[model samples]
Target chain A: MIVAAMLTLAVGTYLIRLAGPLLRTRITFPPGAERLLDVSAVVLLTALVAVTALTEGGGPADAARPAGVLVAGVLAWRKAPFMAIVLAAAATTALLRLL
Target chain B: MLVCLAVGATAVSYGAISVASGLPFWFPVVMGTLVLAGSSEFLFVGIVGAGGSPVAAVLAGLLVNSRHLPYGLALPDVLGGGWRRWLGVHIMNDESVVFALTRKDPARSYWECGIGVLLCWPLGALLGAALGSAVSDPNDFGLDAMFPAVILALILPQLRDAKARRPALLGAVIALVCVPLLPVGLPLLASLGALAVVPFLDRTTVEQGQA
Candidate 1:
């Protein structure tokens, strides 16, 4: 089951990735659609962050996780190195969980 | 490079956690190469680990990856056509796209970043698989927090642009609100509804420009 699912997902995702370049010449997105595409990365990414940080098993995660993500956010906002941001978040969460 | 290190760190966690969840170590190592996209792979492992149906996991993972459609659109030039384009698209992920767009030579940067991540992600997974047994609980070390933290860091710079900020904020709100109500991947898909505000935001920008 795992292997089959992974294979299907890999193929499906590959097609989605290819759809843009393949269709780029044949079709043109309207300006609004293009604008939506432009912002989609940030929008989707923000949503991913929110969902991953706040939810677990279709519900709210513990306070420690969100608090840790908040720390990472502040560090990221300050342009800290990627490793530092990750480490800080992990450390903060682990410490909070320990308490 | 720094990008490779960041991806490797997260991939390590992914590998370890997937193994700890009862997936065979080789499974994540292989998936890391085949899927290549971190977020969706994580979602897939999380669902299947929790005993969700494989069909459901695949569907949810595909939904999580729908963002790649726009990512591919944004980088048509970087991924020039021909047989090479196949590899190009296969390696397209959040890290590659983000890094490629920021460089002066996007085509070269894209390939270099993409290939680097491709190498490190799977290798990191392999290494973490080896270490998975040492750490019985990824959450105890707060490894679970790393995925979202890294992703948040990636998008933070993009959010600095006022044009992008509004939609991101709205999308986040949409996802957060739907978290409890929706299935694992559906909330993220529903967040796409935030794009509805883009037209209105564009009009305001245009009007302000003329003023």
Candidate 2:
């Protein structure tokens, strides 16, 4: 099952990734949808962040992880460097787990 | 180099966790190369580890990865044609997509992806798999926390733009509401549904008579 799923996803994902290069010239978004496309990355990424941070294995995330993400989110908002952001978040969570 | 390492970190940790979770040793190495998708691979492992159906895993992965469509449109110049195009698209992921879009050059994308795919990602996974027993419970080292933290930090810069504020906030709200009700990735996908309201939102000009 795992191998089959991996192969299916690998193939399907390749096609999905290729769709951009292949369809670039063929289909264009209408004006209204085009505007949405502009901000779609932000909206979708933000939504993804919420899911990744706040949930785990299809359910609510545990306390330590969400708290860690909160710390990271604040540092990110303050424009901390990437390394610092990851380092601090892991530290915070690891420390929390110890406590 | 930095980007390559950054992309590899999550894969390494995920590989470690997957192996710790009893996935075969070659799982990450094979999946890392064949799939070359960071987030979906993580999601796939998470689902499969939980004994979910393989078809469901692939479906969830597709929905999560559909964002690549817009990414392709964002970088239409990705591949000219031929086998190179296949190889190029196969390496497409969040990092390469963002790199391509920001640089406005597919060559840079290919270069960075070469760094991530050809060098860092698979090797990281292999190393993690090799050390699987030593790194049991990735969460103890905060590997679990790090994944979302890293992703959120990378995308945080985009929110500095004032125009992104509303759609981002509303999308968060929509997705959060759906989290409890929907399946794993569907909430995030439904968040895109919030885009439909973009045309109607904050349209003071459209509501001229309201004043």
Candidate 3:
């Protein structure tokens, strides 16, 4: 099931990528639909960040986890390097848990 | 270029983090090779690793990747024609698209960065998987928080656009509210409701943002 799911996602994404080059001349997405697509990426990713950072086992995760993620967000907003953000976020959370 | 190294780094984290999340060791490597989109792969690992249904993971991945459709429309020339186009479209990604837009030769830049990320991502995943398998408890290293942090960092650029920010903030609130009420995956799905509010947003400013 996992393999099948991965394949389905891969193929579907490839098709979406292909649709533009192949169908650009023949088809056009309505402006409203285009806007929806644009917003969907941010909307879904924000939810992912929220859930993964804030909730676990259907409740809020330990405060340390969210605090670590909050620090990561500030660094990212400040344009820190990706590796630094990852390392610092992990370290912050680990150190907090130890305390 | 440096983009390849950044891509590889993220793949390493994805590999290690997904494994730490209890996915099979091989999953990240294969998905990195096949899907080759960082955000969607992360979404898949994040959702499926959390015990969400495979259907939900795939749905989330597709929606996140739908932006590629517009990217494709803009890059037909870079894709070339004939059999090469297949590989071209496969390599289309956020990094490649940015390089294609900014570089002197769109086709060359597209292929170089796209193929560069393509090679590094899966290889990095394999290496991270080896490291991840040795760890007994991911949370001990706080690896569990890495996924969300990486995702937050990736989307930070998008959120700078006020047009994107409003919907994203609303969607996040909706998802959080649904967290206690819905099952694991459904809240993310329910977050789609925030997009409905987009039509009512000021389209003129949004058009400028897109431009």
The best candidate in terms of DockQ: 1
Give fnat, all candidates.
0.85, 0.77, 0.81
Q: What is the lDDT of residue B78 in candidate 1?
A: 85
lDDT of 3 by residue, A4-99 (tens): 999999999999988877776576779777667656756777788998899886798998889889999999999998788977888999899999
Best-to-worst ranking by TM-score: 1, 2, 3
Per-residue lDDT of A23-91 in model 1, one digit per residue for the tens?
Answer: 766788897777777687678778888888988877789999999999999999989888899989889
Q: Compared with the true structure, what per-residue lDDT tens digits does model 3 show for residues B1-211?
A: 5557656666777788788888888889899989998878888888888899999999988876776765666553687878988999899986676566545787898899899989999988887888885644557767667768866876788788877889989999999999899755677767879888787786667687899
Model 2 C-alpha lDDT per residue in residues B1-211, reported as the tens digit of each score: 5557656666678788778767998998898888887778888887788888889889988877787776666553656577777777777766665555444465766556555655678888888888887876667767678767866776676677656767787888899889889866677768878777677674744587587
The RMSD of every model to the true structure, in order and in angstroms, is 2.4, 3.3, 5.8
Model 3: how large is the Cα RMSD against the reference?
A: 5.8
DockQ of each: 0.71, 0.68, 0.53
Model 3 segments beyond 4 Å from truth?
A1-25, A30-33, A57-59, A80-83, B1-28, B35-85, B88-117, B129-133, B180-186, B203-211
| Tens digits of per-residue lDDT for model 2, A1-99 | 789889999888888888866776677768766667667767777787788778876678778888988999999899888788888888888888989
* C-alpha lDDT of all candidate models, in order: 0.84, 0.75, 0.80
Model 2 residue A62 CA deviation in Å: 1.8
Candidate 2 stretches greater than 4 Å from native: B50-53, B74-83, B101-114, B205-211
TM-score of each: 0.88, 0.85, 0.64
What are the clashing pairs of model 1?
A: none
TM-score per candidate for chain A alone: 0.84, 0.84, 0.72
Worst 10 residues of 3 chain A by lDDT: A33-42
